[model samples]
Target chain A: MSLSDAPGPRWRPAPLLPRDEEREVSLHFVVAVLCFLACLMAVGGVSADRAARGWARDLRGEATIQVRPRLGETGDEAAARAAEAVAGVRGVTEAAALEKQKAEALLEPWLGKAVLQDLPIPHLVTVRLDRAHPATATDLKKALDRAGVDADVDDHARWLKDVERSAGVVRWAVAILFSLTAAAAAAVIAFATRAGMAARRDVVEVLHLTGAKDAFIANLFQLRFARLAAVSGVFGAGAAAAVTALIELVGGGQGFTPALPLTWMDLLTVSPCPLVAATVAALSARLTTLRLLRGTL
Target chain B: MSRQPTPRAAAAYGAEEAFDPTTGPVVRFQNVGMRYGRAPEVLKDVGFTLPVGSFHFLTGPSGAGKSSLLKLIYLANRASRGTVQLFGHDVERVARADLPYLRRRIGVVFQEYRLLDHLPAFDNVALPLRIAGRKPQTYRDDIAELLTWVGLGHKMQAMPATLSGGEKQRLAIARAVVTQPELLLADEPTGNIDPEMSLKILRLFVELNRMGTTVLIATHDQDLVGRAGMPVLHLNEGRLSRKATRRAPEPAAPDYGPELGPEYEPEPDEPELGYDLGDEEGEA
Candidate 1:
């Protein structure tokens, strides 16, 4: 609490303590670390989801054409026929098909040890569109079905939907992390304010006997804690920025380069986390101090 | 303005203005009653008013409501069924914001000294000024001189727990008078001190009164009161009475001067101690 009575001339006011109180510092450090980790996870998940959504947007309304396993016993002629069949199909302007080996490699990332490589993975053809050839995905699928080859058309929309839903979970986790940081700040502020109140019990009584109103007394503590929280918050935010920078710098050259670095704008958005934490601390301290002072002194 | 103090008028209009603006009593009480919660009353029909700038002794047995009455005057407790005006404003009607100013004008010496045990005597004395927002640097010299006057100059840096009872009482008095408040209330201020110290304290009150501060001392020590030749308000079983004022007899001077010692011998003019309430009639 500010000692408002002290004349300004001779009084050298002490700044209220920052979060550097050993316990407070440690607590902030923990919250900072948690926030940092959460930010990284959130940023990473967001990047992956963005990339997936981009792929989905590009693939929507398109069908892939694959031609292989013709009834006749030659693969090359079947591939040649597959190209012609797709070009002639309504709604298909062009076709660039996947080589069999390439499809096996795509499956290799998840399926493992494919003995079927020699047996021929299917020849997958992706059909491109000419803007005015008005044929729906259903019409294309029916055309591929009539072809002698075991051909299939994939719209890719359902796959995108699944990826989008999974990304939603990551976003939810980020939201929860934000809430947890706030709750932690409030808890720490309450604990610290209570300790301060206990230590200053006699001082409080003297103030009361001197006819100080409860609001005046409560304001002193509230303002003190506000200063403490603000200072801590500024430092915490600075530290978070520094750590996030280091993370981006170090995580940059690694194999797991964050799918994409958080843009300057995104980083700027996160910059206020420390301020929010501090505000939570200040408000919690004020509320706790007022509540306990009301009940006791 | 020249009217003699009426206990009722004094209570209705506080003691601060009861005296002639030039020469009236400083405090007056009339039918002042106090109770705690739903329990029975602690003080009943208390009535008296001290003359302007006069020193008086309040004597009653333990539990006789002496402290409660002092509390009412000091604005610590309110009267349950009567008015207690201070400086001419009814205390009950006084704004909360203004209470501090009123309290600031009245000095109180508690029996316990109520020293902020953590602070040294110098700081303790400076508390009033500090709370009032006076800079420590500004009042530091004034406090030092007062502490020295009370013979506590050497112990200025000492804590309350370390000081002897006499030293503590002196410190309490120094704190009470530092502001030169209009009224001073002492509740057995000398209870823990030696007779020599008691007389020294009594002399301090007399000196303060001479300087025009109104003082009311509550103590059961009749010998102390009689020797001082001050009027006494004796309280018994929730009732109050005023004993006649008598002048000291042709006297031998009691040496109450500053010699640090244990016993205080009475002057020949001093009346015999006669305020034993234990032998009084049954309580009402």
Candidate 2:
């Protein structure tokens, strides 16, 4: 008879961490996974929110100043006229020539405060428009050309677009990573349960012959694995939470750091990770048992 | 159930008087053949009808497919060739999900005793009842009484790995009969036990049969088969040869009898089931 015809006993391999092994990890692993997921979800939400809010603020209160040179006027003279004309424009809230000092302050965070003291900075104007939405840079530039100004608009829309798209990419990437990890965890647990079943094959065969149904046999392993996955999940999530908490605590004490801070909402998002881990365990155990039983006893 | 060629041939072969004439048989195998994957035929053109409540011995040497035949009866393996009707139902055509329900109606004892080492004697004996979804409170008294009858009243809590050879055999028997199965299939149950224990177990089998449970035992013990006086379904090299008018041997053991005292001793730690007969008055 072929090997398939005389199918081996309905036993699969045991999990890497059997019940008698270091069971603590298995128990806590589920919770730990939840924590990790919660953190990732929270951070993504917060980062996206912050970027979007910053873009909204810039869009609401900002305007562009442009200059166009008349046939004989110097670029400097045109720049001066554009600034003066912007200052005179109706409903212009605060039209200040953007000083080298203010520009240097923006660069201070990146290039250090002292580096800008020796450099020649660009001459620009910062305008707070009173209208509901900012005017398009193109419209503002055309208006400035009619006014004999030789400068162009800078509304920072392109910069905002880049920021928003990058945040979106990160959110999607995190989602993909979460799904893949959960699948991997399921695969690992399934294989382990299969092995455990194989090792205890005689037990299964005897049970079957003596009237144990396949469901009853499968239920036993399912419960055990779900319990194990829950524990492991808790451990993994707890570890992640602790690490994130430490980083946040350190950053908070060091000053207004540029790093993303963990909010209660972020931590809360990962709360379901443990439950998902348990689900993974149960699904893996169930699928493995079903497949193996189908092939064997 | 139609006029199949194989079944007709098998019935005409050597099983004419193999079945009992008193009542309908519990298991009827007509032209059964089984083969493992791609292997040459193991059991071929086999047919036997085990009458209800009849005690019979199936004799064959090692690897003569004795276990394979028993497997078919127990629904462990399906026949590749013909029909096996169990408890009046065609097994080959039955639904796979229906096997568990049918299996609960049968009991089996393996050559190795196949006891779960982790569970104690009580749990092992109670397994069949448990699998049938009997509540612990519902079947507790029945299981207790059966264990006591099997002379394992005191060893209920003892693990199989620690039990003596004879004790293990009795435990296996108790588990098999706990559910009051309609049919019992034993493979070399007496192979590892002492002659005295063998006779005791044989008497147990006869008692079960008399209680309306059909029993089929596969053994190489000539004397045990002769003592039972049951028809011998002799199998050799995949061919069955029926022995005509097999005679019953004398009840008493002859020269090779181990000098076990006639008196039954109650081991000190044995729990009291209150059946302390001084000795077996006579051999069966």
Candidate 3:
């Protein structure tokens, strides 16, 4: 850093603007908190989406059929015929007639065995659909109609619709949370820029009247706040990621809860947080500085 | 950045010759009026001209608007009314983007020695050149030479807070002249310094003036004005008039304090007063 070095040392000019240290630290804290909340929102959104899809998948894979005996056939024979028809359909992976024993088991809790034996129980069939291209309700109806078996099919479409709607709502809430966090960060940066200008008005005045360009003075605050925001963003993202990892570690395979699961891959989503924070800070600082300079001059 | 040096020519208000910078004044003010943001005018109907290489002392009491007039020269404030022409370009017509370039051609040494506290003495001195976009390698030696000339070579690395008042004043001077501006304006350059330092600053201005930079110093020190032996543009209560001659015993101007010990005196052969200051002083 001395002048006597080999080639005259490059004159690294000192920073033209100074940040009041206490306010800068407080600003860092506010921005870091916003970033952490944003990361949590992002991770929560993804997990909720996965949970909804899982519920829908379970509902889609299984369908139940209620069978009424034909005039000449017994209830068991009718149920077996229905299963055979469904098994021959294109998307049915497996189908079987529900035996009387399993049917009794399903009804025993609601009705005492003595009353169940006296009552005539309905015969039933269970069908498994291929997950990738499950059969639609219309397809199942058409197949039953072709077999001439008197039966009603229930594909759990109502439950699937409700799950999808809940997932959509979660998606919207996460987007709003993320947007609010970004806006709060921008506001903090703008406030810091204004405070910085107030703290060093004399320096700005001298630089302006001394023929320094407006861009030169503005660049000073922009770079300073940008660097600060980037560091804050790193801390925020790191803390969020670490907390998520801890949850995953404690909860084993199905993390935290089945409804909202955390996975190792979700941490990658937070990697760009620091860069986003820095960009927002730079833009906020630049606009604030230009407005102040133009207004004051 | 200043307009080319024009021929030493004179023009008065409403003069009917085609205006030419190649032959016009370095600065021309015609019926100029200035005020700060809707306030009452502080300067009114002022007119003057400084030709190339002229040095003048602007002397008045504290409320005489001396600083306001200097602001108009340095492009810190625009005239509220009338014409202000600097280096032959009408300031009103200059675009906002061009104002900084125009200011680059003029150097200002502030009353407060507005050196930034964070910068070392050398960086402070090198600011103007840096703002003008000169490379550090090109101006580094020149800065050292200028600092050495101003008695600051040994303190080049010292922060501004560490320097004494006189040292700060001289450091401010070095910053102002690092770019070798065509015009130099100083506001109360001697107020906070000792008498010896005051004389040293006066000599620096004289030397800068000799090097063809037009110089204007606003001060309350009667001794500095008398010792420099330059024409005085006396401003009083929003009005301006020139003394035009330096012969001592200025009847038209305010009393130069009898305390200005025997260094300057009235000359018997000098006329009563050369300025058209009229019967106001006659009554006095």
Candidate 4:
């Protein structure tokens, strides 16, 4: 009879770590919470970035002309002349004089509607520039001066710069948050591995005495943690996605449109969070097991 | 069989003369001393040579460092102070990667019977072969045959916790000898078994020794030692001494009697028989 025809022994090494149901549940909960927070931070950072870009794009070629009432000229007349002057500029596409009430309404939120009418608000002339042929703020101001209108030209560049700076800070914060979460998860897995090794010291010693290699023992732990991390990551990602969808729905119900609308693709970005968590867990477990084995044996 | 030159014999000829490897001992310890970290030495100035294919019993009371000596021979414990040579190569000089290869040639039945409680009797016996990277199918029949010879065939599927103390001891012996190691170091092989089972286990070791595997069994059972009629290496308070020999007439055959049955024949092609086993005149 050949060796292949003989019956084989049916025995496998029991898992080095006993399955602690409570501990497993707690770990999953912790990992899921971290993952959710990370996903939310990612989404918030990306949305802020898109909003800042949109604001920059819309304000790029636009300027406003504010006219003051001269001694003999009415505010309306000055604004009309300024608008006409802006229209004749090289790259100005359309210029219109703002109505007195509409101009006062712009300040209504800060100054109160009752106080706005009595104040001598500047007559505002809004100008839209042809994006293909942009006009400089200096040229527009020079044109307004020649038209006998005393007006100040504002290009909204300072506001856009502030927005971009805020967006950059948010992005950095989000990245830091993601890194801290990953590190925390890895720490948890490493601690768990150490405890498992201590608990299974007898089994490990026997295996070692029996000539089992360090790599063989480490692989068992690494694979277990990786699987647990993956499952927890998925649950965490799902919860975060649900929370984001709820926020979008509520915001939409309040007649608010997001700066950039949420799409299926935006939600799909959270899918990789679990994979990242799993990698961290596996690496942590492997390193911890090897280090412990080296020290003990 | 030829014997290796002992340290005393070598010293008489002066240290300058080198020993030949072809006829050297299977294990040699020269002034070996061992201690745990920061602890007093457990074994001191231990020096001996187990010539190739010899059988000896290590006898001492509890805490006499019999186990520690076995550890030294099996490469589990490195001597704190002296040189240990196994298979004619210095253990201290052997690389860490090569230690496992050296350990494979030595089989040890631990005093505690260290069987995996989770594994069945058959798998426990098959452990050494498995560790040696033999496919299970390749060693299945051999494991079954060995387990049966140890009288554990009925308990082949039994877990260690379910087995009796005697069965556990037998299983451990089975595991140790499964790979047919060149040197077998059994720490108290018959300590927990009945006299009948003890004799059977000793016979198994005797049969293994006859097949050219060197055997060293450490036990405090002086009766068992006396019955075996082999050379005794006595350890007292961490000191070792070789007791005088008592030779008996060689038996024509090892008549284990009708109790063992005809199936218990030692393989005829075994290279050498270490000793002849004869029935005691008044035993039956």
Best-fitting candidate, scored by lDDT: 3
A41-158 in candidate 2: lDDT tens per residue?
A: 5555564556555565666567655444568975456556776767655555666665556767877898886777776555566678765545556656666667766677787777
Q: Write the per-residue lDDT of candidate 2 for residues B42-129, one digit (tens) a residue.
A: 7877777776666667887887888889999998888889778776667765555556766887899987888887777777777777
Give the per-residue lDDT of model 3 (tens digit) for A1-297: 223311245765566775578988898899999889888888888888888888889899989899999899999999999998888887889989999999999999999889997989989899999998888767877888999989999898888899999989999999998988999999999998998888898888888888877888889889998999999999999988988888889989778899998789988878888999999999999999998888743
| Clash totals for all candidate models | 11, 49, 1, 0
lDDT of 1 at B97: 48
Q: Which 10 successive residues of model 1 chain B have the least lDDT summed?
A: B275-284
Candidate achieving the largest DockQ: 3
Top candidate when judged by TM-score against the true structure: 3
Better of 1 and 2 by lDDT: 2
- Candidate 4 per-residue lDDT, tens place, B97-118, comes to 4555567777889999988777
Local accuracy of candidate 3 as per-residue lDDT tens digits, B1-284: 33432232222222333444333456788888998888889888888877667777787788788999998988878899978888776777765656676688789999889999988888888788777777778888777777877777778889999999989999998898877788899998888788766776676777776676777888898767765566677888777854543434344433333322223333333222223232222111
- How does model 4 score by TM-score? 0.78
Ranking by lDDT: 3, 4, 2, 1
State the weakest 10-residue window (summed lDDT) of model 2 chain A.
A1-10
TM-score of chain B of each: 0.80, 0.78, 0.80, 0.80
Candidate 1 chain A has its poorest 10 consecutive residues by lDDT at: A11-20
Better of 2 and 4 by TM-score: 4
C-alpha RMSD between model 1 and the true structure: 9.5
Q: How close is candidate 1 to the true structure, as a TM-score?
A: 0.64
Error of model 3, residue A29, in angstroms: 1.1
Model 1: share of real contacts kept: 0.16
